[model samples]
Target: MITPGSNITDRFAIVREDMHRRYGQYFYADTIDALLDEKIAQAKATAKIETFLPVTVEREVSSELEQRAEAAGRSGTARPEILFVCERNAGRSQLASAITHQAVGDRVFVRSVGLNPSGGIDPQVLEVLQERGVPTGHMYQKEIVPRTVHRASVVVLMGVDEVPGIPGDRVVRWDIADPAGQPIEKVREIADDVEAHVKNLLDELGKTNFNAA
Candidate 1:
């Protein structure tokens, strides 16, 4: 059973073995363990709840490593990147980002941020996501990087009035309710709305470019 209390070193070994099995090209014995440890420790330090903590750590750390591995193997290109922004950065922004990442994958570089960051991502949001099978491990962004606003091809505003001086053509705003402090059922309703918006955005993105990866 997955638990928050699983042995850390043992979990690291499991992640290493799986990384090798699935992505051995990305796994280097001398470096991968340390990288994984760094990521897991970071997650442990930031996570608000311990539920399925090890699973969350493994999924997120592996994705970060995978992106690095893939980037190291290829030339750079200016892919369409979507940046989701909100005040708290923990709930609505993250849920939108996560759905976008899953729905749109390598077709776009996806990120989310907050104006005033919250302590870790909201745990209730994570709980609602668990019910949707969307994997809530990677919404760990705690700060809104200014460069993210400049770098994005599209900026999505959630439950925020506005971001000053962002081009009108590049910004999209949704009127969905915030996910923080809402009951699980209400949050689930919000998740459904976010998923619908994600699907609409994906359609607007055109057909996926399999070659982008």
Candidate 2:
């Protein structure tokens, strides 16, 4: 928890510098500052651990900036973006996202979020992914933000029925069990299922080059 007198400014400064370096060509300093401040406030409201608030805010800002750049045809690639959504974002969606990243590398851009994000990731989820040599360093629990949904080329739903405002054509539903509080064995099974689904999705994506419309 960040206290009133904590050095939040220092933490925010780091985010500001990094954002300016990456996105200054597209956004004004003041605009970035305002967006950064809004993200920080939102993070404080929803984040269970404040230790990585700055990093989370930076990610949110970067996502929005990337969307804006793409809209303006400034982003270099027309890569199809995939967003995985689930109830908590700790298990099912996370598994699918990590597996997709492992399978596709940078050929596709993938992200996962929860409807109501809470707690950290399930330990078993991390263990299973690590067992498969999948990278989990960048995986974090985050709530679904509006821009996130709007920017997705494909919104994959796992144990989630629907998300408001997304066009029906962009959504894909998966019937996967939640891995939270499950045993490692069960978690591994879930991981296997997620891996299979990811492989199929990749194949459907034709390895690369997709028309997301």
Candidate 3:
């Protein structure tokens, strides 16, 4: 647990050691450390309970490293990567990524990012996602990172304009409404719309056995 005046250096060292052991072969030590700093900084900015910051940073770094490995064909079976992007990762992109994960599981790698990330997830969005049985444990508002863009097989953009890092062929726009401040009923409607798009995308990707209703 991080507290005011607590020596964060030790905690960060532990996280760095864990990551190095897991991804030392695939990525440079400098790269791992840089990402560790980035994740910690991001997590600290919005963490409700400072105690969970280390755990959150570790998980975020591991996810990024795993995606990097898969993108470079260094990991095991290469799963199709899907990245969902919106203005703020608090609503639409979160729904899309969570719904897609609930549908395909690990058979396809899923990520969500914002052009300009918000401080947290939307409460109404959380309610709708829980109603659909999608796990919200790993969900967070993340700013789009370069490597995350470069690795995606498909990038779904919603309510946002150009993503300068990714190729045109990989981008797909969804006209779904953003649920940031909408009523619960409207958020549900948006969730249904997101689910429909996710279903079709999984079908197109040949991962047709979707479990997301």
Candidate 4:
């Protein structure tokens, strides 16, 4: 039980006790206090009811912390990386990587490579993503470094015919139509398909609790 001592507000007492009961073994009082402060700060502007603020903040912070703890536990194992490859870096591969990154955050190690090594991302693809409000974080230069393919748990081959298909259950293809240099309508179609596919893949792989990026 927590007493609302001189420094501890009744709200803090409730939140602290709840979190301590839930995760005190994994975190110390000072650390949990810091987390509580951060969570409250994050929710300060929200117009939600006051009666449940502590509960809501505690739930969100605890969930995020639990996920981080689980990821830390798997440090001994090689990170479960997902590699996305396509003919060029501009379109489908980037879209898939961006969607997956957004859904899983850093929970899965995501790397995208282009066999053809295009120097720039396609404008139409960027336009579509912007319309949908997806953040395409860090557009990396595309290159087929041998090490990435060898380390990936799942290697996805997107619409790129030049490279020979990698044979294995771990390697799959999206069969999405390449949108590079395509008309805006065509690019939009490819984007929609990629979004759906990425969502499904995240749901499927989330069972394994992908490494938090």
Candidate 5:
């Protein structure tokens, strides 16, 4: 007797009554039934599905830095800050941080900080970046303060050691090499690693709606 336009709630009520009558004592009338009923109610409440969304802060920052560096080389201006991060702010973190800043011109900011920052910037890291025409300013080590995190709209983490206590929703990790006492070639490999990660991040950010206000 159900019509197409009949209320769903009324139809369900009728069905439940029929089930109870037919099954009698065999019907699930315990806590399991209650749980199933609750789940069903929740599903009915949220029947519509939502679409997936993506954000790429790290990628945009990397791209912006690269472009700025090229333009700055052509002209002669200071770049903006593009913060690079890792565990100790000495090896992988310092290298990635310096390269990113140098590759991007004065229009972009570039800085590197660490979670447990120790040791000065690695000399080998500095050399590779310099070869790529990226400048290495005074590379001191500092802990990642709240102000540092706030200053960066995009943050890149190079290794597990450098992993900060920041929210995962706002951080990007690139598992690169730790060029402590390794050869110069090994440091270059780490630079390549940083470059690849940065490019991927930029591509991802390009596809997102970052201007959502």
Candidate 6:
């Protein structure tokens, strides 16, 4: 039988090796290093490692009040409104929103919503974000609303199910693995994945110039 606290590194190594075997391109050392480097650069520039905010909720009128005022009566502005959504409003969604907000600065407005709202934001998520020096102000778990959906420029889905009634063009599915009730190490791994994806998305947005006004 396996010991409770025995070396699990070997097991992890085996799993990693198996993953490499399954996905050769992603498992290569060079590719992994490049991805890590990109994530590091993104984290350094933004000073956060958690997933950035979703693309949809970031465009809400409440979130972009100042931007809206700036373009009052005009056609529109050029910023993107991003919304991050998950099963619960606590962990992953919060991390993604916080990271995105930090990564894009004030240029993009970011918010997070939940299919089934939780009591409050997860403490562990807050702890991880604080460690990365990302401000936690204005972070809270709230229910998804029609207004939230209508306002988002892009809606990122962290959960499995597609958010009902959201427009097809506005939706972006991330399918991030949930980190609830897991060990800190597992949470960190998930965070790293989120960070990588956020960097990729940022790069895509830069190339596409998909921001709305």
Q: What local lDDT does model 3 show for residue 2?
A: 32
> What ranking emerges by lDDT with the best candidate at the front?
3, 2, 1, 4, 6, 5
Residue 199 CA error for candidate 5 (Å)? 1.9
lDDT of 6 by residue, 132-212 (tens): 777888787877543334356787888747565554347788867788887777777777777777777777667333221
How high a TM-score does candidate 1 get?
A: 0.59
Candidate 5 Cα misplacement greater than 4 A, ranges: 1-83, 106-108, 161-163, 167-169, 207-213
Best by lDDT: 3
Could you tell me the TM-score of candidate 2?
Answer: 0.62
Which model, 1 or 2, shows the larger TM-score? 2
TM-scores of the models, in the order given = 0.59, 0.62, 0.64, 0.56, 0.51, 0.59
Per-prediction CA RMSD (Å): 11.6, 9.8, 10.0, 15.0, 24.1, 20.4
| Candidate 4 per-residue lDDT over residues 157-208, each given as its tens digit | 8886544544224877778898877999888888778877776676677534
Q: Give the per-residue lDDT digits (tens) of candidate 5, residues 1-213.
A: 333344555444443333332222232435234533554465556655211100121223224434644665643422223457777888876766565544442233445677777667778877887787666676678775432343344677776645456533356667677888989998888788777665555445442211100
lDDT value for candidate 3? Answer: 0.80
Report model 3's TM-score to 2 decimal places: 0.64
| Best candidate (score: TM-score) | 3
In order, how many clashes per candidate? 0, 0, 0, 5, 20, 20
TM-score of 6: 0.59
Candidate 3 lDDT, 89-206, residue by residue in tens: 8999999999998987767767788888966899899989888888888777877542234357898989987654754347788999989779999999999999999999999889
Tens digits of per-residue lDDT, candidate 2, 18-134, equal 676567656676988898889988889998877778767878998998888789877553556678888888899898888887776656667788888888899899998888888
lDDT score, candidate 5, position 192: 82
Residue pairs whose backbone atoms clash in candidate 2: none
Q: Is candidate 5 or candidate 6 better by lDDT?
A: 6
**Stretches of candidate 1 above 4 Å error?**
1-77, 146-149, 165-169, 207-213
Error of 5 at 23 (Å): 72
Better of 2 and 5 by TM-score: 2
Superposed Cα deviation of residue 119, candidate 1 (Å): 2.8
Question: 94 in model 4: Cα distance from truth in Å?
Answer: 0.8
